[model samples]
Target: MSGVASTRQQEVQRIVDSLSMAIAQHRLKPGMRLVEAQIVDVLSANRNHVQAALQRLALQHIVTIAPNRGAKVARPEAREAREVFIARRAIEHAILAGITIGKMALHNDEIEAHLQAEEVAAASEDRRHIIRELSQFHLLLANISDNRVLSEMFSNLMVRSSLIVALYQRNDTPDCQCQEHRAVITALRAGEVARAQAIMDEHLRHIEQQLELDDAPPPPITLRDALLVSW
Candidate 1:
């Protein structure tokens, strides 16, 4: 029975991760409902498993479970959106400070690979791929920070940042600047930790500035259609 229970838990976690990735990749926009029936069909999972997965996401604040509206991707409030960036500034700054010149050199190839992928996605004009790759660049830096705890914290922030961008960013605003990413890399390569940190701070600030937090909320769209088109 215990083994059966553990297997069930793993299955639920798999669904949770899949949905989380869809949200983080921006394919699943903020305020979009997550219909359990559609998820069960899309993923070929049990209804119970789908419900458990959504509950887990709700705990993480990635999904919100209302009294009667069911689960929907969280649309963070303006205040919460500001807080996310503020938290990012502190956490990302720490990530840069913790990285020594030696560590940066060690991870150089991996970091460049992510940047190359971002460039390719941008040139191809694949908006979805571009968003995913751009987010990966920051995650790559967090991985190189060599602090597992901080890396995990940064990962959560990145996820929330994606939601914030989806909810607040202007339609015409680009989420990431490849040149700025390259500049940070150059600073790291030159062993200028402070420069790298400063550039990262500015980059994050620019991203925040692009958001139209005061804009009215977008109308809700069908979850099944979003999942079908995106998946």
Candidate 2:
């Protein structure tokens, strides 16, 4: 019975992860509707598992569920957007602090590879790909920090931030800057954790500063289009 239950939970988690990735990739815009029936059909997943997965996302504040409206990607309010950034600043600070100078092993090549991917995406002007890459850079740093707990916390925050950006970003505002990511890596490689932390703070603050945060209406996007790539 336990094994059966575990398998069921794993199935539910697969749905949860796919949806979360879609959200983090910016393919799933804020307030985009997620009809359970459509998702079950698109992914050929069990309706029960699909509902469970969305409930999980709701628990994480990544999605919102309404009695008759089903679920939609969360549309953070202006105040919630500001608070999300504040929370991220705290979480990311702790993640960076775990990388003490000369204590934790750092991997530059992996991050460099990620940066290269970001460059390729930028060259092609693939906005969605670029957004995914930018967010992954932070997740990469969290992994390198070697604090699994912090990594998990920051991962959730990254997705929430994605929603915040999608909803409130200024028209002229650009996606996360790769140069800033490179700077963070450079500071880390030089054993300057404090400098790296400062860069990260400035980087995040710049992104936050770019937000219009006026409760812009969430744009239109189909749930199938958002979750298709993930499946």
Candidate 3:
């Protein structure tokens, strides 16, 4: 019984991650409805798992479920976007505490490797991959922090941040600054927790400031385009 339940849980989480990645990468645009039947077919996932996954996302505030309407990618309002950044600063502060100043940072190689990949992706100009790579940078830090609870909290925020940025961001806003990320690594390695946190604060603010929240919300895309995204 436990084995079966574990399998079911894993399947549900798989669906959730796929949807989260699609949303983060801009393939699943905000305001687009997520039809369960289509999700089941497109993901080859059972209906129950798809339903469970969507419910989990709703709990994360990454998806919205209306009374009569089905689930849709969450389109955060301007005020909500500001609140998210505020919450992000708090979470990142905790994440830094786990870094343990004066100690060698774990995942040093992985850090440099991801930074290289970020630069390459930025140069490639593949918007989907670039966005995914940039977001993964924070996820990597969460992993490095080795606090599962904090990691989960930040992961949820990170995914929601992507959605907010996609909806409210200015057309001219460039990808996250690669140089700022490098500066963060340097600060962390030097056991400069305050400096690292400061860089991260500035980095996040730069992204949020670029959002044209006064403008209209992004238009809803078709359900098919939303669900047809490949994992």
Q: Judged by lDDT, which candidate is best?
A: 3
> Across residues 77-159, which tens digit of lDDT does each residue of candidate 1 receive?
98999999999999988988777778878987888788888888888776677778888888888888889999978877888
Question: In model 1, what are the clashing residue pairs, if there are any?
Answer: none
TM-score of 2: 0.93
| Higher-ranked by lDDT: 2 or 3 | 3
Error of 3 at 65 (Å): 0.9
Give the alpha carbon lDDT tens digit for every residue of 1-231 in model 2. 799899999999888888888888778888888998998998889999999999989999999999988898898888888898999989888888876544334465676789899888777676677787788888887887888888878888899998888887785235648888888877777788889889999999989887887877666778888877742
The CA lDDT of each predicted structure is: 0.83, 0.83, 0.84
In model 3, the runs with Cα more than 4 Å from the true position are 101-105, 215-231
Model 2 Cα RMSD, 1 decimal: 2.0
Residue 64 error for model 1, in Å? 0.7
Measured with C-alpha atoms, the lDDT of residue 69 in candidate 2 is 82
Q: Candidates sorted by TM-score, descending order? A: 2, 3, 1
Pick by TM-score: 1 or 2, better one = 2
What clash pairs does model 2 have?
none
RMSD of each: 2.4, 2.0, 2.0
Question: Mind giving the per-residue lDDT tens digits that candidate 3 earns over 84-153?
Answer: 9999999998897778643435577788899999999889887776787888888887888889999989
